[model samples]
Target: MSSIQDLETWEPLLRLVRAAHAEQLAAPGGRFTGQISLGSWTLPAPQPRSAPGRALQVVDMQDQFTAVERVQAALRADGASGVSYVVETGPDGRPLLHVITAGPAVEHGVRSPFVGALLLVEGAVPEPWRRLPEEFPGAAPAPSADPALLERTLRERLPDAIGATAEEIAAAEARLGVTLPDELKALYRVTRARWQDWSGDYAAQERVSTAVGCELFPLDGLYIADARSRPCPWQYAAKDAVVTAPDAAVQGLVGSPGWIAFGDNGGGDRLALDLTPGPGGHAGQVIMIDHERSIGAALRADSLTDMVVNHRHEWRSDVAWNRPPVVVQVSTHSPVGIAAAARPELEVLRIGPTGAPVSLASVAGLPRLRTLTASPGTLADPLEIAGLTDLEYLSLGAEEWRLLLSAGAVPRSLSAVAIDVPGDQHPLPVLDLANELLALWDRPLITRTVLEGDLGTDGKAGGTR
Candidate 1:
């Protein structure tokens, strides 16, 4: 038997693996006879492979997850304390692949190993994967006591607060035509407007954004995004004012004529107050609602004062839009380029050049990220990578879109998504990914939007939202 260390002996297995994968990708018109050979392996024809060929060469490049397992297996099998290996697929089809590490893997202690390459295929990228973090059901958490030292944190951001005067609150209410919640009124007394930014702890800072200002619709800086807009939609309101999209969806989610906007999370979700007291429910309670549609709502607090005093954290708009990314798309495969992609809040990662598909997985157990995105050509199943429970938004090419649609491997937890459907292919099915989402997840279906192309007049193209 050839030892695993003997690169020459492992040639046949690599050949079989390569040929098997390429064959799976074969199609009649799009049929490709080319094969990728890395290291000592050769397919039907053994052409020269360039430096550091790819270890994972399955149609879905992510299948090379086994490559990681093998490296760690080598590390532990040989009793080595640590192991490192590099696998790169050059521009040419033939790659120079090698696996010299040993062990099931332990940690990323002080050294860096060769991470996998994430392929980027061209096609339609899905929508729910690209939304902002604040788009979630509730940011931070349901209302609780504000984090300690919030006053200090606010002081750091806002200075020269305009004390709330009885006349000021009264006049504001008269103009707006709604009774201010005690908590909201107190917040006005404390600060008129403040930027939202939080980096302390994820759980504690969940919905601290509810306290910040919205330039689009500033109700004393604490603007409610999905709440009742101007021209108040109340049963009784000023005759001259124009009514807007009520936070309650005008009897869609929860029937409440009395509603008020408090804060906009930036994306679409908003912090609001249900002013109408139901038979059992109390008035002036804080709640969360989706702005795009009447999905549902979550009660945040008994009152705005409760949210500001207890259930809040410090968050302001650092992103021009609302959500921070769990996954990031890059344009290069160079190590230096990938290093630049790291940030404290980022979870998932990808590298995709225009024509060249990017499929990478060089590191594992990423600290705090919940989702990862990649090219469908490389990793058909993202779960193969350890610790990846969810995926960030995807920007895909056409061939990649066909692959994912056929396989249907997208995660179920994703609630907010964005996609760019191409208008090239004819006789394409209008993609109702929303319907698919509604079938999969129990919550109000995910928020889906198309950025670039639309499902046009003539027969729409593939991946049309």
Candidate 2:
């Protein structure tokens, strides 16, 4: 039960809101908001029927009044759609802080900007804004005296905060030689209060990310410092846009775009590489790259094109490199070559239907090859894949000719096979593929079929149900 004074920045304030909301959530009829932002964006209100159960419960607790009757009256008076409530175990008893936000209801009914502002009024001022205590003399300080200023700060700093964190990461990568995972890099970009390293500086690195944007880089992931030109580990979606910057360090000449590089000598795009498992004990056989674009593509090898045949340029910096400029590009370049070059003992290969023909031929001699995923790839090399008798799971893509032909011909030592072949797409029946593949397995395979017109409908089976 820390006072609002305990929280100076919006981060901690948001944290308190979350904690208070969570406490209220633990009680009956308590609810909190999904996101804590200024009442600017046109969000939908919580509906009793539409937002039933947890969905209905999770309202903007920070915005509503504590009294249930007051909250209900406010909602009815304002003609608002929904209000969130937090059940706080006060000295007296379990009291609630009701929250509401501007949405379609406010737009059509009130048509007043003040309505949005009114919802943010606190019973007491938080400590962060004691100087401007009048804002919420009874509750917590709202910090910025100017309501518009507070709103603007959140709008500006939220994205900038995201960018700043990215910069810290890029600078770190530039210091180290490896590009981080898409999930990991995303963890840095999304605005949240959890990024406090032991130093407690708000991961101050984000200051740099906000400065750089589409003009120079994508500003999507963290910039890294690296010595070796390692592969990136970001999974990308196709709708994502990628632009090459003229700056050599960022233009995929020395490193990938949307990423900064810090070489060992601080000269070219090379940086230090950390193959060891990071802070948590979770480590993997990774090919760390130096660019965010490549990181995006590499991690999403199935969805996007790799960095093959793309334009390659010279290093932007004038310094000589102790190590070769690791070629950086999208994820779908020559995967066969990448796999061969990686020569991973345990690799997760992401091939497309186009590269399916030569997939296993390249990784045939990979003594360390362990796990394989033929994601986004139409079909895998049945004969070539069969050779890897130590395989754990073989996730089949839309392509089935290769796997269908192998049928009972597969290795008996294989463990699991996740098939996603739809009936209409396949000339052969799904049952035939399932029956044949099941016969060759030492263990029962997790078989699945995509019925015609029912291509992506099962949520539990990776596709939509």
Task: Give the top-scoring candidate (lDDT).
Answer: 1
lDDT of 1: 0.37
Cα lDDT of all candidates, in order? 0.37, 0.31
lDDT, candidate 2, 1-465, per-residue tens: 111111111122233443445555354444332222223222223222424444434354433322233333434555544432221223333333322232321111122111211111122211111111011112211121223332333345455443336667676556545575443344235332234421356344343223211111223333442212333211111111222222212111222322232111112222311222212111221122324332211110110011111111222221222111122111355433444444443234544445434446655655544344455443344556666655443455434534445464444433334444432232123334444454443223222221111111222221111
Given candidate 2, what's the lDDT at residue 247? 22
Model 1 error, position 14 (Å): 57
Candidate 1 residue lDDT tens string, 294-319: 22345556555455545443322111
Model 1 alpha-carbon drift over 4 Å, by segment: 1-328, 332-336, 339-344, 348-351, 370-387, 392-408, 430-465
Quote each prediction's TM-score.
0.28, 0.25
Query: Cα deviation in Å at residue 248, candidate 1?
Result: 34
TM-score of candidate 1 versus the correct structure, residues matched by position: 0.28
